[model samples]
Target: MPYPDKFNDSYSETKADAEKLVMRANGREGLLTCCIRPSSIFGPGDKLMVPSLVAAARAGKSKYIIGDGNNYYDFTYVENVAYGHVCAEKTLSSEDGAKIAAGKTYFITNMEPIKFWEFMSLILEGLGYERPSVKIPVSVMMPVAHVVEWTYQKFAKYGMKVPQLTPSRIRLLSCNRTFSCSRAKEQLGYEPLVSLKDGVKRTVESYSHLQAQNHRSISKASIFLGNGNLAKTVLWEDAKQTVTVLLLLAVIYYHLFTCGYTFITAMAKLLSLTALFLFIHGMLPSNLYSPLLSLFICCIYLLSND
Candidate 1:
């Protein structure tokens, strides 16, 4: 299919314009330029595709498939994409290879096209998250996407974040975007350095931090703390509150305990500080400092015992 004369978003429009400029500059003033179009590039350290998919999964929005879920895509692994670029550069620099590759565009991939939804399922499942099960047709979702886009445009200045659901994105999810790399194989000697399966595995392993297990009620801290209320709030459980408590405790220790004051004087000062901290904490929102309050209570109990 030929390139569309217009694009739905400025991102796609600018990218198309840039590619055209690069193609136009190919043979001018000894410049050897070519476009390496990697299809649906993915893998570890990908800031766009994987993150958005994971975000949707976390947000409970990944339950529905965008279309019939039969859309095939050539999802290129990051390493394979790098290899493709290397091949292109080597071919462009070589005398024989440059004859065929210098001015042409090449579609690079892992050569293992998979059903788009299946690939999405693999990543989600690998990360201990549920795969999309409900299928919604593109026709049904397009209008919803349009509404969402319009709402985002209207409320964007009021701190409404840009939405993921858009007409172009919906089309991208539902379309068959597989590409043949035969031209690249014959001209540039390009081949994927990593298999698609391994790529997906590596990508999943890289995001262990975002695994569903970590987001569950039975987190590591909870398990270690015997699932007590303090277990969920103390130490490393809530990092922000833990750090704040530690800083406060450190100040109390250095300013009061280390001053060579009598035990009664130090205890009196500590109680006064704790009372003031609790008073201020009570004035704030409940969720904002509830963990701090719990930590402070625990500290007071421990000090009483000491």
Candidate 2:
């Protein structure tokens, strides 16, 4: 096959070049190229598309759902996509290969097509995050996306480009783009080995490593924010006071609630209260404080009922 230079940038040119290669390789004995177009390929360690969305959600950047979020898309697991390519290559090179080569173009994806919002919710749940609450229409985003794309293009001429909410990207988000994988399944016996849930689990495991890196970044940010000894001293003192209050509350709750001996219950309550107080104090000026406070309240309620 003749490799076309810079084919990734131009789909039409790439398809034409690929067709020529397929025609030439027809009835040939050795190697043949098969083009497998996969839909939204994603898995563990993915840094683009879905993984980017996941990261944005975690960082609170993705606050809104585009359109009604009812659009369906065929999402293919990266490993399954790879396997399809392998199968295509193997089938094309086999002795009775004309069966595989005759007008063959495979739409490789997971057999199941899922609604966009449902998939997003699954991803959020897998990562222990809440689903997005806001929704915006495609019509509303069009003008904004146009302006952003125009600004980006204008800046590109000056060799200075900025991130923009692009029109093409918005269109993709709004559209229902589900691909048929039945041809691939029939011809190559291809079946997705990884379910969406399993794939998300793998992705979450990879995200745990990234979270450790993020923790170090947050620690550095705290140091930077508390620039002086006075700031540090004030913060620590506030934290200590909060801890003392929480400890007292915990002791009262445990004695009245838990069946454990008074001493053990008091100690357990004291330690939990101390940790919760420090965490709450540290998270002030951040959005996490309210949720953490609510969680603590719930815990107290449950303990009292016990």
Candidate 3:
């Protein structure tokens, strides 16, 4: 339970408590329970870490490092977790090893501790993202992270997903935490199948679609005015496109509300245009018609307004 000297706010208190529950159940008759604490689990099909990191990278928020980049973190590959569990099970079931493995706790990891920021750089660079270089003091980051977490907690009842940069996450990033898997290695015969480099490679390849090079970063104003990358590019990437969209919106607004058209007449005219569109759509060949479908759909939306 000793915390690192540099950081007072140690991460994973909840998980630490859960680990204790297994330890408490350890000596119960006919029961075999042991806790496996895996650090920073990352791999393919990882919905939590991978997606959140990628989202931050895509948002250009991954360009800043909290505090010095020297903190060591134990990162475990997902497959290694599976392997560790299997080894634990075998050790628990085998009469020869049961005494050594049962009623115990083990730290599961790749046994390769890297500087936390360096690990982030590896994942980001592998996924064609910019490695975070700008250093921000933890004192500065903590307040911002606190505000973000508070805001999220306040609005979470309205169905908001918790953001990645919480106070605990900041502490984890800015502090050192390297767990020993020596006991697991000696007792359960658990060895990491995936090296850190190999695991990172697999993770990056799994998320090819989220590569940073494929996207264009934007400013906060652009994001607020527009919605996101997809929305910005589709609407206002080109000046002509922006103008066209605005003009169309204005036209629709004018016809529906500004002009002296009755609701019934507008509805009737909208239906007539819709019928004409369907007629043209039907006449066009499949290959030729497919690409223009979105434009026609937009036109339908425009007509429906008036």
Candidate 4:
């Protein structure tokens, strides 16, 4: 599926086979051609999926799960994907295989279907980032994501980065997208070379710099050490996280009291604000140290908005 600001995601497979028509036309010229489609490929060397997730987590934009967190997806580990390729290559070279598997497409995966958000949580927590707990139902987020995508499309020439909350991306997140690897298993004897857990661990370990604890510890000294102790110890234990929660509360306070906005209207507005924040936060360049700190600054900026 194509995410906002990217025809690449939607067009990748076609692009990968851009010369397929030529190959097909010149086929039986002793050409054995096949395509291996791997789902959500991730592992130590992954350049897209894992990096993007880490960026969102560090930016505090991964707090909201865009659905019920029940969507099932197949994530293919890099090693497993490579193994599938080897199987395909060997199969294509065999005596009985040349005519049979050529000009075919095979879906390769770890073959373990996991709830999408659970998979996300495992990766996040493994890297020491907090797992997402808030559920933003697709109904609330879809329209917002669409607007982000459309806006990016319109303003890309003016330096808008491709938005991360594209409607296509919401669809990808909020839907079940598991693929069966039975064909590859039988035809090519392809088996996953690594389990999903190990793959996630390896991927998380590969990105040592993004480790969540790398953030400097926030000052924990509270003004009222005894009376404020309860909220401090139980709810706002982490000073930085507490600051964000306070910001959220402040926004709610202003809308409910000062602004005189209707309760429902205030809530709708809050939800919209949350979505916009996630969109901008997720689009931030996952650079070294800069955007990470900028994310906390943005959270503090939310107080000014209130």
Candidate 5:
């Protein structure tokens, strides 16, 4: 494969540089070295990929497909990657095999080029989450990702945490990344022991704590919000209530703290305004009438529509 003149990210750039360095030192000082490039290494002990997927799922972000969802990817199991390394080392042990394998790079995969979104769906479904059904085009997501990446680049040093969405990641999610493992198989005798299907099943089963059923624990705030069918509809539990409270707190903070007035004075003024408003509104027909019945119906409507 032809190397690009410019890489999308530093991670890819560094990997390519490291491979070049390793290949350069292949025959020097009687040292044998070869680079084994594994495609999307994932399995039971995976920390980054699986955890990130679960986090996205919980955050309600995993319902989106970044592209048409037909891009092919070669995902190698973690054990298969390790086995590839072993194969490279064993190949280097023999003179004939060393000539063919050393000073070279070999792509390692499960040899199962599955549709990228299909693989993601399998994992998400296995973990008891809804499969991503909404297709979003790459062109639509790329500009947003670029803006986010640019923001992160500027604010990253100012206590801003790294963002997950970026242009490179968008490309990764939408582009085909399958690589042929013919070189590895022919030169180093490398073949995946675990199939991709079994690897995904094992990976999903390993992260049992991230399952949807295990994640839906009722919080204290939900209990305080009445915890009935009507309450659930109106408050919508943590996602909605938490956001509402945060916005409310921001307003309160600006008024009470950022303003010139003292905290006690601001509190008194706020309470006074609240009491006056409630007193006036309490005399209204809407409040005097069956408010519960009206509120219940409104909540039901919002719940159904939402």
Candidate 6:
């Protein structure tokens, strides 16, 4: 089945897709549907959120806590979420399936809501790192996010798809989006096996082992501090060069497909294209993007009305 355009947003889309799938399986003799919506999942070998935070702390990038850092979130251990899914699958039957049918969503959190900053601090402390001290207000961050997103979009048309301080990310940092896992507990009889503290201990232990291996590998070689710094600098420079090449390619592609004639005219067209990109980039700030994008869309409506 095709996903609706409105499902582009994560919250809406994920729930919408689950509901659609469940509805399709309804009334089938052997089919049963169970939707387990897990909260912010963290465990060993996680690459996206938890590991990224750990890396950022190690690299001295997690010292700045954005917004009030007091926002609460329901974080679930990966094993717990998996356990809930397994329980649902085992219990879901055609006779009992209707009890867990379409539009019935279960929150699969650990039933513990922790403040964002506290969670970060716990992870850092577990890893033998200092907790963050700097706190930036959401109001001050909104404009900076706007500019960063604007810069990315403007250059992206020129082939620079650089990271932007998007509005959604800002909201994630600032907004309180805690969910209750009562439904999962009641229906699937799901319970989280690992506590947050135990999870952090396990994660830190694994990271320490990996770091020790890295140190051993480095010690085996004749590598010095200067050599490490030089290698890092070279890698950073190479990445910048790659982005520049991609930007040039984007400009060339835009000119080729859009029928812009002569160098001056083509550059002018590119400027207009870049402006549109900048507008989109500006809309990328996690705090401002949602409202700004809606406004941009509204303006399009007003203009079309004429």
Instruction: Score residue 264 of candidate 1 by CA lDDT.
Output: 83
Would you list the C-alpha lDDT of every candidate in the order shown? 0.82, 0.67, 0.77, 0.75, 0.80, 0.66
Report the C-alpha lDDT of model 2 over 76-152, residue by residue, as the tens digit: 88888888877787776675754665546778887778987777776666666667769899999989988887776
- The candidate, 3 or 5, that scores higher on TM-score is 5
TM-score of each: 0.69, 0.60, 0.66, 0.66, 0.74, 0.63
Kindly give the stretch of ten consecutive residues in candidate 5 with the minimal lDDT sum.
Answer: 238-247
- Give the TM-score (vs. native) of candidate 1: 0.69
Tell me the spans in candidate 4 whose CA falls farther than 4 Å from its real position. 1-9, 12-28, 217-306
Top-lDDT candidate index: 1
Ranked by lDDT, the better of candidates 1 and 2 is: 1
Poorly placed runs, candidate 3 (over 4 Å): 1-14, 27-29, 152-163, 213-306
On residues 30-119, what C-alpha lDDT tens digit does candidate 1 reach at each position? 989888889888988988877888777765667789999998999999998899989999998988888888878999999998999999
- Please give the lDDT score at residue 224 for candidate 5: 65
- Residue-pair clashes per prediction, in order, are 0, 0, 0, 0, 0, 11
Compose the digit string of candidate 4's lDDT tens values, residues 115-202: 9999989888988887989999899998998889889887776557677787778888899989888888888889998998888889
Superposition-based RMSD of candidate 5 using all C-alpha atoms, in angstroms? 12.6
Candidate 2's clash total is 0
**What is the TM-score (0 to 1) of candidate 6?**
0.63
lDDT of 4 at 6: 46
Candidate 3 lDDT by residue in tens digits, 1-306: 342345434345556666778878876887787778788899999997877777887766788889988889999999999999999998888877877887777899999999988988888888888899999999998999999999888867655566777888787789888999999999989999999999999999998887876677666666675445445646566543343355445545656786679988766765665455445444655566555655755775687666
Model 6, poorest ten-residue lDDT window?
Answer: 216-225
Scored against the true structure, residue 177 in model 6 reaches a CA lDDT of 68
